[model samples]
Structures are given as C-alpha cells and as structure tokens.
Target: MVLGALGVCALVLGWRALDLQVLQHDFLARQGDLRNLRTEPLAAHRGVITDRANRPLAVSTPVTTLWANPREVLAAREQWVKLSNNPVLNSRTLSQRVEANAGREFIYLARHLAPEQAQQVLDLRVPGIYALTEYRRYYPAGEVTSHLVGFTNIDDVGQEGIELSMDNRLRGTPGRKKVVRDLHGRVIQDIAVLEEAHPGSNVTLSIDLRLQYLAYRELLAAVTRNRAAGGSAVVLDARTGEVLAMVNQPAYNPNNRSGVQTAALRNRAITDVFEPGSTIKPLTVAAALESGLVSVNSTVDTRPGTIRVANKTIRDHRNYGVIDITTVLTKSSNVGTTKLALAMEDHALPAFMEHFGLGTATGIPFPGESDGMLPIRSRWRDIETAALSYGYGVSVTALQLARAYAVIANGGIKVPLSLEKVDQPPQGERIISAEHASALVSMLETVISAEGTARRAKVPGYRVAGKTGTVHKLTAAGYADDRYVALFAGIAPAEDPRIVTVVVVDDPQGQDYYGGLVAAPVFGSIMAGVLRTLNIEPEQPVGTYAGVIDREGRL
Candidate 1:
C-alpha cells in the first residue's frame, strides 16, 4: 500500500511539471515576458553641419540628462536635496523647486550635463533616479553663422534657419530594443534589437567660411559707421548659383539665446523685402531692349531730371539731359528708366521681372522665406509703371536682387539658387537673348566709370559692373523723407563674370545715405577681398580702374 501511494504522488508531480513546461508553455511564457520585459530607447547622434570646405559650423557633443520618478524620489529627500544643490543643476534652490513637482510621475532634475557632472549625480545612488545619454548642439561659428546655420531648441529640436529647414536630415531616429528588467526598472538581461538606430546624415552647405567672415566684418562696419538700423549682404556664384556668403547685421549668438529678440532672429537676406529703388532699372532696361523698343546705344531724353505721370512726379538727382541707354543705367536716371517702361507694351516690365525671379520665393530651403510684393492689378497706370521701373511699386529681398543680377552676369541664364553645395552647375533657363545680356553687361560696366553714380564701386583689378539705389523708406504715413534704404548690386570681372553681390544698408543716419556713398564701398571692399582669396585674375589693368567723384549729390 505504501509503494502504491508513493507511485501515485510521483505520477501526479510528473504530469503537473509537463503541464507548466510544455502543455501550457505559450501562455506561461507570455505572462513571464509581460512582467520582466521592457522596450528601451536607443539614442542616436545628430549629424554635423559643415561648410563647403568641411569646416565645422554646427556639431553635437555627448551629454547626459538627469530624470527621476517622483514617487520613488520622494522617499530619498536627503539625496534629492544634495542633487538639487549641486553645481550641475546650477541652483541652490532646486531642492524646493523639485518638491513642488513631487506629484509628477517623472521630472527632469538637470539637462545637458557633462559626463563628469552626470557621474556625480549617479554617485548619489538615489532610488528611481536615472541619467540618459543625449546630445547637445554646439555652434562653433556662433554669431557669424547664426542667421544661416540657425540653432536647435533646448530639447534638441530645430526652430529656425537651415536647422529647421533640414530637420529630417539633421535629426536622428531613435531605435528600440527589448530587454529584461529588474523590479527597479534597471536592465538585467540583454535581448534582441527590434530595429537598428539610424543616425542623421551630415549636411554640406555652399557657404564659404572665409567669405562669410569677410562679409560679416564688412557689413558690421558699414552698419556701425552709418549708425544704420540694420544691413544685409549676399554673395552668389555666378556660374553655379550657389550662395557663397550671406550675412546680416544686429546678429545674435545662437549658442546662448538669452534676451535675444525676434527681430534679430530673422534671416533678413531671404525674409525681409524692401523697395529695391534703382536696382530694378537694369531689368526694366532689359525688358525694353528685348521688346525691340531700343538698342543698347538708343538714347532717351531725361532733360530737366523730372517728369509728371498720372498725378505723380518722378525725379532724378539732377538733369541728365539726353543720354544713351548705357548712360541711363550709368546715371541710374529715374526719368530715363520711366521713359523706357512707358515705351514697352503693357505688362512688359512685370513680366520680365517675374521671369528674373522677382515677386516670388527663391525656393531656398528656409522657413519664413518671403515672396516679395508686386502689384496684383491686371493693368498698371503710368505712375505705377514708372515707380515699378525705378523699383518702388515692387519689393524684393536682397537675395532676389543678387539672383537677378546673376541672371545677366550668367549671360541671361536664370539658374535656380541653392543653399547646399552642388556637385555640378545646374542647367539654366534663358530669360533673355544672350546678345541683349552682353549689351546690358557693357552698360552696367560704365556705372563704375568716372562719370557714373557708383564710381567708388570699381575694383582695383576687376572690371566691376553694378548699379546703386537709394529708396526712401515707406512708412505707415507714406514714404519717409528722413529714412532711406541704400543698396548696391555688382558683378566682378565683368568680362567673364564669376560672382554677383548685393548689399543693403537700412535707415542710414549719417549725412551720406546714398547707395554709392554707403553701400558701394562695402561691395567693392568685399568683392576685392573675395577675388584675391579665390585667386581670380583681374580682367583690367590696376591703374585703369580708379575714379573720383563728388561724395555729395549722388542718386
């Protein structure tokens, strides 16, 4: 009887063991996994941003973030107090602050800690406290490239400029893995990776750091010397349409954005639009030349320096009398440009302007890129036409003017502008006949001659072709008499144009506010340095480029 009883017990035990290990294996295994398994996030690093020459503009460095489970941390007040008063938290009062949020399931104690700092927190050995490995963006170029490179928020997310525009390419995708964990939420067993982490791909911009610094220095000086509100300068490769340099005044350091205003945050080169003044005259001249209304040598009578049209009077600085089309541009005669516009068929000037990439966004990859305003009326009146001719009715950003000039410098080919480095030059669309473009180039060249408005724009070793503009600021009460936007757009080595630059000085307060006096020198100085740095040979004799002019009374 004893042997039989023992046999029954052994048989019952064997059957129960089989039921748990094999018969009900699926359900039992799932129950075990639910209790011990967890999905963990695998951190990935953001890609570095570099210039065309691979110089670092923005990069990410390893950092640690301190997090705590409030429920668990409330029991370790002493350790919590110690951490709150630590230098890594940058606070002697954080202990009280943390107590206020004790009801939260999780809270951040400190963020962006150095490895050593994070280790010190770990040394506290508080329950439910943890450190997460993360990255913090660091901008080496700082304020110099702030407007272009932009910056990420404290959460490591992009908020402006290239960072915002290319967020997908700059931000890495976090991965996941399954792991066995202890009751305290610490990983105990390694498990299979659910997916591999995808790090962000690096970005290469067309910006030349050397040229960017040059533009930044010169623009800052111009703004300071003139006591102007602000300024912007753009340099573009005529051959490839690459933005070599873009700089703006009143810049802010992105690395530390304390007390920075939204006004200083704007990337003014592409976002801010203003009346281009006489800068649009070149496009108007191109339209007239293309419409068979005039040739490069055809003359317009600008006598008396002023004319009345449709209840408005457009005037030049002084009487230019009758002058050739080239001379009209050389003098930037508003009367002459108006006459050219009046000669064209209706919708001619605006149509040509649109084809030159005006009144539209340049399709650059940036946020808040503005498409400048153009008259939406089906037909423009005579005064409207005249104003548009001299760059008043229509508005444009500095980048648009640079690109428009680039079209002429590129022999009438309109290449799409780019902020990224292109391996090859983009195929361009012809906006005007090559012959007409050549004629326009010749006319533009004379604008830097002894008798023209921008004589100071002549580069010592390069044949510079450019125009100057001085437009009265348009206020809520109409055009302001005391404020002006001084502008200059020029091309270097006019024979074989390589680069086009545009400079805009806003609200110059000095006695000399004309574009030639204020903006042309900046253009000349920047282009001269650019040519020398690039080793571009001079197209003209050094002594042949000098000119003298009266500093006052310039249009």
Candidate 2:
C-alpha cells in the first residue's frame, strides 16, 4: 500500500511539471523577464550646424549620465558607504539623498559627464550606480556666434536663436531596445531593438565664419571705444539676400550656463528696433524717383535749414540752402527729406516704406523678431508725415534696414532673406523699377564722398554708399533728453554692389554721439574686411589714387 502511494505522488508531480513547461511557457518566460529585462534608451546624436563654409558652429559630443537605483543602493550599505565616500560623488550629501529616496526606482547622480569622468564614476562599481550614454551640445564659435547660433538645454533641446528656430530639424528621435542588465544595473546582454534611432538632419547656415569673426571684432572695438550701452552689426549678401554675419555686443558664451543674463541672449540685429533717423532718406529719395515725380537731380530749397509744419519745426545741422537729391542724402537734410515726403499724398511715403519692408519683420526664421511700429494712413498728421520721412514716428530692426538697402543694391528686386545657405538665387518681387534703383544707388554714393555725413564710411579700394542716423531714444516720458542711437547702413562697391552692412550703436556715452562719428567707422572696417576676405575684386585699380607717392614715399 505504501509503494502504491509513492507511485501515485510521482505521477502527479510529473504531470504538473509537463503542464507548466508546455501549456504556460509564454507566461513562464514573461515572469523570468520581469526582473532582468529592460528597455534601454538608445541615444541619437543631434545634427551638426555648420556655416556656409562647412565650419562647425554647433555640434554634439558623446557624454554619459550617472544614475542609480536608490533602493538597490541603500540595500548594499557597505558598497554604498564606499560610493558615497568616493570624493567624486560627494559622500555625506549623497548618503542623505539616497536615504531620503530609498524607495525610488531611479535617480541621477551626475549628468553630462565626459567619457573620462564617467569612467571614473563607474570604476567604483557601486551596486546600483550606472552610466547611460547621452550627448551634449557644444558651440565651437563660443560667444562670437552665441546670439546667432544660440544654445540647447540639458535635454538636448534648442533654447534660443537658430537652435530654437530650427529645433525640429536639429533634434533627434531617441530609440529603444530590450537589454539584460546585471545585478549592478550595468547593461550586460544585447537584445532586439524595439525601434531604430533617427538622427537629425544637418544644417548649413548662410553665416560665413570668416566674416562673422571680422564683424565681431570691429563691433566689439567700437562699442568699447564709445562706452555704449550695446551695439549690433549685420552683414548681408546684397545679391541673394543671405545674412552672412549677424553679431551683437555684450554676448554670452553658449557652452557656459552660469550667471548668464537674459538680455545678453537677445539677437539685437533681428529683434531690437530703433528709429532709423536719417537712414530713411535714401528710401525717400528712391520713392520720389520711383514715382517719376522727381529726377535724381530734383532739388529742394532749404535756405534756413529748417521747415515748419503743424506746430513742429524740422531742421538740419546747418543751412544746406538749396541742394539736389544726391546732396540732400549726402547732407542728411531733415528739411529736404520732409519736403520729399510731403511732395506726394500723405500715404505715399508710408506705402513706399511698406514696399521696402520697413516697419515689418525681415521674415527671418529667428524667434522674437519684432515688426517695428508704423502708423496707419488715418494717423498720418503733417508732423507725423515729416517725421516718418526722416525715420521718426517709425521704427525698424537693423535687419530690415539691411534688407531694404540690399534691394536697392541688387537693382530693384526684393529677395527673401535666407538664414540657410541657398543653392539658387530666389526670383524676387520687383519693388521698384531698375532705372529708379540705379538712380538711387548713384545718389547714395555721394554720402561716402567728401563733405558728406558718412565720409568716414569710405573704403579706399571699394566705393561705399551709406546714411547716418542719430535718433533720440524713446523714453516713458517721450524722447529721451540725453540718450541717442547712432546708426550707419551702407552698400559696398557702388559700381557693382555685393554686400550690405548695418551698424547700430545704442546710447553712445562718448562726446561724439553722431552716427558719422560713432558708427560709420565700424561700417567701413567691417565692409573692407568682408570684401577682402571674400576676394571681391576692387572697384578701384591699384593706381586709381589722384596723386602718386614720390620715391621718398611722400604724396
């Protein structure tokens, strides 16, 4: 009877084993997976950003994140004591944090560690500490291109400037795969991928690093010399409307995150707006020529250098008397520009400005681009009209002014500005007749000649045309009593236009606050450097100077 009972028990045990091994094999396997299997994140690299010359502006480099399973860490107190005491991890505070979150499944011990640093941390072999592969964004150009290239956040997402503007294209999709981790949470076994990672597409911006450095150096010098609040300088390809360099003073390093002010992050060239002052005179002249109401030789009388309209008086630095349109621009005459603005209907000047992209965003792909304020036709008082002509009662970003000048430089086509490198020149809208544009260009050339407002803007080998603007900064109490914004916008090689440059110096504290004195020199230096760096042929031959030096090197 005892033997029979033993046989029955054995048969029952055999049957139970067969049922579990075959009938519920999937369930058994799932149970086994719960403890050892993990869906590990496969990090994808963020795409690199390069300048037009393929020089790396921003790139991603491999990094590691040290994490821990707090529960496991606490369970192994002896190992935990060693890990906590490992000076690199900071013993006392680490011990406290682990104790406080002992129930937690995961915690970050250190983030964004270099390979060497990560290896140093891993060498401790604490029970729960693990290093996960990740990436960190790095900017090669540092503060030089900070405002233009921008930066990314801890999660590798763009936060400002071009990085933010093109975030979608610059961000990669993180993938996942199954993996078996050892008791210490180290990945030990390879498993099937759940999804493949897709890296972001690379971007080639229109920015030329060579030109960018040049602009930065000159702008920094001018701002420091003048003791200005801040400054911005922009360089654009006049033919294709590509922004080659956009720089601002008081910039911050993107690679460093400590003590950075919000104001320093602003890309002033595209976002900040100021009254353009006399810089608008060239556009007003171009409008008059476009309307066929005046020739390039159209003359305005300004015997006293002042004009009165609607209880307000507009005046120039001195009496320009009677001057032709070209001389009017060269002198930056407020009275002459007022007459030109009022020559037509009240809305004509504003309409012309709108067509030139004034008081409007330049349509750049940057964030926080301001569309400068412009009044509607209904608000056009005589004083307002006069002020608008001379760039008051209106505001524009430096980029907008650069684009408007580029349109004139390119012979009347208003091409869409591009931040990315464009393969082909865009077919543009004709904002003005080519004849009118040419006439305006010829008139602007006078501004760089002797006796003009911006004579300092001239380059010896290349003809330059630009306008000077000194506008009072608007305050809560109205125009400021002392603050002023000095501006210079110019086109180079007037015979065959190539680049447009705009320099803005905000509230220069130096005794010389005029645009001609404070900003024109910056424009000249940037233009000359850019022209030479691009290998653009000089408009003036080697011996084009009127007087030759004697053998003693005396002129």
* Candidate with best lDDT: 1
Candidate 2 backbone collisions, by pair: none
Please give, for residues 1-555, the per-residue lDDT of candidate 1 as tens digits.
999999999999999999999999999999989978878777877889999999999999989888877777667666555555666653344455457777887788788989898888677666667777788999998999999999998778889898999999999988888999775556789798997888898999999999999999999999999999999999999889999999998899998999999899998998999999998899999999899999877899998999999888888889989999998998889999999999888888888899999999999998998999887779888888888999988989999999999999999999989999999999999999989988888898888887788877868878889999999999999999899999999998888888999999999998889999999999989999899888898876776645543464232
Candidate 2 runs further than 4 Å off: 1-31, 542-555
Clashes of each: 0, 0
What tens digits encode model 2's per-residue C-alpha lDDT throughout 345-446? 768889989999987888889999999877776757888888888999888999999999999999999999999999999899899988888877787888
User: Residue 14 in candidate 2 has what lDDT?
Assistant: 89
Q: Between which residue pairs do clashes occur in model 1?
A: none
